[model samples]
Target: MTTLQVEGLTKVFGRGAGRTVAVQPMDLEIDTSTALGIVGESGSGKSTLARLLVGFETPTAGAIHLDGRPISRMLSMPRERREFRRAVQFVAQDTFSAFDPRRTLRDAVATPLRVLREVTGPAADAEIRDVLGLLQLDPALLDRYPSQVSGGQRQRFALARSLVVRPQILLCDEVVSALDVSVQGAVLNMIRDYCETYRVGLGFISHGLPATTFIADTLLVMRHGAVVETGPTEQVVDRPEHPYTRTLLDAYRRGPRRVVAVDPVA
Candidate 1:
């Protein structure tokens, strides 16, 4: 199983007057077959942490290691960079705009297989169709552009694209916040199943506690760009140590549980 370790990971935007700290220095590690749920309100830096872990945002300072090797030094080499990307993926919050409206869904999925895995032509088509089938998405949707489908469809398609690469670590940022409860359930199930079946590590970042806890076994609560509390999902949910975590849990209970949407434990 792949293990991703980060120490003193930090992200700061700008310098001097305009400086803003997106993610405070944090230490964490994740392994395949485990789900780490990141919960926080808007601007809490949960997304920033996901972006940093996936290399979408370079850390202002800190060190990252994948399977004991330094990520930065590995990324500098083309071979290792491609390998690193194939192993880690980030599913962003905005699934709609995450795609290019100009390209057909088939092209979008095929791009990764062609680039990262070096599969081409008929092989790419085969893999794309297979992943679509795995996600239970209709193959016909592959011919349509991103705008031609519903939000749920786009989200599934995006998921299929990521799964096509067979990533070892999947970092999802607020994937279910927009979809209705029904659609959310479907997407969440698909993600959990894939991760379980493939022994893939998951980083679920979201503001919604239920949605995040539904997929994550471990909880990481954040506020003001720093971690507030973290531990087993049940402990943090039932016996939150920090006041902020208790506030999150209290707010969550006051709302519609929708606990039936997606159950975490298989």
Candidate 2:
């Protein structure tokens, strides 16, 4: 049940001596219906890899497969490209910018259904309500503008939009980083619930390792545009093998009677 596989993936920007390496060649796998976390510091190429996987960016070299089909190969056809776009979705960091300012949250979330022809009739209203409800959002607020909602609500609405399409894999890029701790926890629970209910896979990318630790089944640590460590979530958290992984774990540690005995730095 390996839903997504990335092998020898690399993404470089610029050229010659001034070139920058965004992501060094790396290999990883995300199993179906499970959560995988990519943890790293800023500029670690975590987001670069995510963009490549979700088709937002092409890789400089290497391969990625979605359910056994290579991403590069899949992009060559119009029909397959459309299918690929619908099958995988991304949640951006800035909720406001992700949507059109002219559109209400309802229109933004409903655009996908309208495009895919998956929903129609008077029941479309109910579909919106149901999706909002799944995100613990009030149905009444669906008509409100994004500016009228709180940051948490805006993020939730963004999430609702992605889920409205019922994608097979969700690529969440620091989806909760801008929210308060309480809001973050609630959103995380909702994501976990949605994945369980629909049996869909999730790829969570974040610089904050602690935030993702509760939801991810597997952990991949990246640094300097390369993967530093990866393994089962608990194993990686409990026994991190790389210096950068240790640094991230240390950053989340509360200190003095830390919940976990991890090195402060590596």
Candidate 3:
């Protein structure tokens, strides 16, 4: 099933000739229970596309269909909007900042369920424990504040919170960028595992090609507010077609190269 379909999506800021096209008529689709990665350098509009998907920002032109229904066209009904919000959730690049400094992790994670009236008392506790366990987060740390936890812990907590709401699709915006390399892999793998287990669709937005290559089934490369290229993740990483895509791959290659070389005995 097609979880998301975006067509002719354009997001422009400013006016006239001075307008900045954040996203220009982009087209994309994501299947159910799968993962797609959108990679781009800074200012490439990857995050802008994510914001549009989750209804955080209004697009200048075009349409987004979530489960075959156009989200942009449902503004008339409050019930539909609430349903849309419940169907999709976002995990920001920085979890610590997205959370409250005074709130415990459990309280923060439970905020959504509390508002939605989905669980209470013992049910809420079970819900929290289930989500945290799914994310591989230790139960002992639920009482800690965001500031007291490591970056990886915070990221896992963010994922836990998102999952607690039972969202069908998750828009993850560089959720692992701030973590240590070793921790990054663990948290990312946890995300993949959860998505597989729950059949939740994921759209991962990041500049890290190597990391994206590990979990994504599809890769979409954006350059200057447009999709430069897209294909299977392995194919795009191994055989990039667009010049911009090549540049991204080259930039991510490991180790220093001999930029200028001469015969050693010369």
- 1-266 per-residue lDDT for model 2 (tens digits): 44778889999899999899999989887655679988888899988888899888899899999888997877888777767777888898889899887888888888887675468666777787888877878877778888898998999889988888888888899998898777877788888779878888889998877667877888988889988888889899889888777877887776321212211110
Residues 1-266, candidate 1, lDDT per residue (tens digit)? 89999999999999999999999999999899689999999999998898888777789999889999888877889999999999998788697678998999988988988899999988788888888876778889889999998888888888988899989999999888998787888788888888998899998899999888788999999999999999999889989889999898999999866534443211
Find the candidate with the highest lDDT and give its number: 1
Question: TM-score rank, highest first?
Answer: 1, 2, 3
RMSD of 1: 2.8
How much does candidate 3 score in TM-score?
0.91
The local distance difference test score of model 2 is 0.81
The prediction achieving the highest TM-score against the true structure is: 1
Q: Candidate 3, which ten residues in sequence have the lowest lDDT sum?
A: 257-266
Instruction: Select the stronger candidate by TM-score from 1 and 3.
Output: 1
Q: Give me candidate 2's TM-score against the actual structure.
A: 0.91
Better of 1 and 2 by lDDT: 1
Off by over 4 Å in 3: 255-266
lDDT of all predictions, in order shown?
0.87, 0.81, 0.82
